[model samples]
Target: MSAPTAQRSVLPPRPSYAAVLRVPHARRAFTAALTARLSYGTVSLALLLSVTRATGSYAVSGTVLSLFGAASVLLMPVRASLIDRHGPRRALPPMATLYGALLCLLAALTWRPGAPAALLATAAALAGAFTPPMGPTMRALWSELVHDRALLQRAYSLDGVAEELLYVSGPALIGVLAGLAPPACGLLLSALLIVAGACAFVTSPVMPGPRPAQAPHKRSVRPSGIPGLLAPVAVAGGVGLALSGLDLLVMAFTAQHAYDTALVPWILGALSAGSAVGGLLNGALPWRMPARTRLCCFAAALGLVIATTALAPDLWTLTAAMTLAGAFIAPALTTAYLLADELAPTDARTRAGAWVNAAVNAGSSTGALLTGLLIGAVPLGICFLLSGGVAVGTALVAGPRRRRYADRS
Candidate 1:
């Protein structure tokens, strides 16, 4: 008789989001992580409003925020490197405590009238520079805990959604709190929640600590991980360029048409709403191809759709093109998150995430510079066209690495 043929079991390309939650202590960890990160979305707006209220100059507030933001972006990867070298538990708590304390101090200083804006700005920079690297650490933790590829994808998707919601609601909450309490109170609340949440997350039952004895993945041909690992960082930079340009394009569009500034949010909301829907759908549904190939496909679609922005003659039409373009954003990001997890050196995964984050920040700065030069010189539509071209460039960036990531090994 012929030997029995062997059959390998096939897993779905995507799994239920509930499966991610059902894992031991997954809910607790995810919840704590989410709350800790809410500060990411809330703190900036709260600080901006509070500082502006106290100082009475948008220039001072902008300077303070810019300094804090620049410092935070530059320092985050350093903290993430520490987290990876040690572990979240050892690296997160102490820093979280100190950062949170600094945040409280900044808030207190901002609460009083006649505070020196420059000194407060310097203090804010120091506080934010040391802000605990919670977001990337939680992502690394999720990657470790959710061993199943399918579940990990969903988890990242959920993270993207949570990020969008927090960003939208954070600004609105600051507005509401201004009516009910001191505006700076919202900043203090964000600080406290981050402290509590970071502590709880580390203490969660499923969260892992450093395992020095455990070996890491096979080294890459160069100093980086897989050949494609670094590509996502570049792609992230491109995406950021597109995002900042889009924001500026909206501002110009509003100004050109005499549309109320309040109406700009609706257009912006259309973009974010598209991304949120895409993230939810992507998490729930499996892709037909590998994440890498599918991501390139999404990038292509985003580029092409954004190109249509140049053709849009009205606000509603431009909003439609923007929405279509935004649909690809979260999916590309989710793919990048997963790819970075798969390909990063086990000891540097957190750093990889932080590097990607930094690239995005740097790209935003670059985009603002470009937009400043382009906004008055050409049609706003042409500026979007340039950003779309950047999106297409991301696809080109990923294309060379496609074979490396098709790997289901």
Candidate 2:
């Protein structure tokens, strides 16, 4: 071989997840972000238990949790835009502090048996309103910290896997703590986690510096809304809708088949386990396909798997199908994030990630609501098809149009 050709062949190997953490200050930043994000995982369960215990009314608890979730999910883009405008250092701390204080207030209100349901609901909503946007901020930081495209892909996969684990384990931790102490204690712990984590995270040298103050004479240019973002946002939302519906549908399936309801958790666990494994494998592969194309493929694959699950005659078959469907979840979301990063301007990166995050969450809420309504009135198999159909339809709508537009250009 020629010397130049030999030199190209000997170029350094691709970086691993370990290399992601080894980037200066990456570990500290990542750990702090995870610590704060865990609060999200724990807060819902803790709030549910606390409100239920205080009011002794399932109706009250459900309403309160609904309010909290709505406030948290709906406001993510607004909070993320604040981070984009002011930088994480300036924006995150204030949000975390207020969020923690509200959580603490909620803990106090729910500490005893008889706090008014109104007070509990108000505090919960306020706490959610102030919840910091840790995940988006961390993803944005990752883009800044790791410039190598291959290494960045690994970092995102590791981050997604770790986040999935955090959600799975966080509720379990809260469950144990609630068993040992008052459920209110779990709320307090969540408060502590967010405050400490956010404070530490913002102090990291890897964090972007504050946005320069704008002159009064000139208005800042806002992004022309969500044009380039339609594909990722729609795909992410579709995935969320399908996954969330799968949970309720599985429960309904068990009930209908007279199988043990206890098995639902195990089935769901399979889904999560498959996702974790798939995320790792996705990152490890050296893909020749464009990210947008890979994203559409992943979404389409998930939709097909989920749709096929409707035909499973037994719980075991359903579990296997769901596990297969889960394999595509992380890759789809990760690629959507990658595309969002590519499409967004630098100043709006945080908001772009937040839009995707918000879409997932909004779709999740809608899925659960709609799935709950359809389970009894509609056939179980039809319900599954509907859930899966959302994803397939989204992929079809978003995929070809972009390529056709490109061709015309």
Q: Which regions in candidate 1 have their CA more than 4 angstroms from the true location?
A: 1-14, 211-227, 401-409
Cα lDDT tens digits, model 2, 1-409, are: 9999999999997888888889999999999999999998898999999989988999999999999989998888889888988899999999999999999998898888998988888888888798898999999999999888888888889988899999999999999998899999999999999999999999998789755433422122232364578788889999889888888999999999999999999999999999999999998888888887888899989988998888999999999998998899889988888888888767777888888888899899999999999999989999989998999988888784445354453
The per-model lDDT (C-alpha) reads: 0.79, 0.88
Give the lowest summed-lDDT range of ten residues in model 1.
214-223
Task: Estimate candidate 1's alpha-carbon lDDT, on a 0 to 1 scale.
Answer: 0.79
Those runs of model 2 whose alpha carbons end farther than 4 Å from true positions after fitting are 1-9, 212-226, 400-409
Clashes of each: 0, 0
Per-candidate TM-scores read 0.89, 0.94
State how far residue 319 of model 1 sits from its true place (Å).
Answer: 1.7
Residue 389 CA error for candidate 2 (Å)?
Answer: 0.4
Worst 10 residues of 2 by lDDT: 215-224
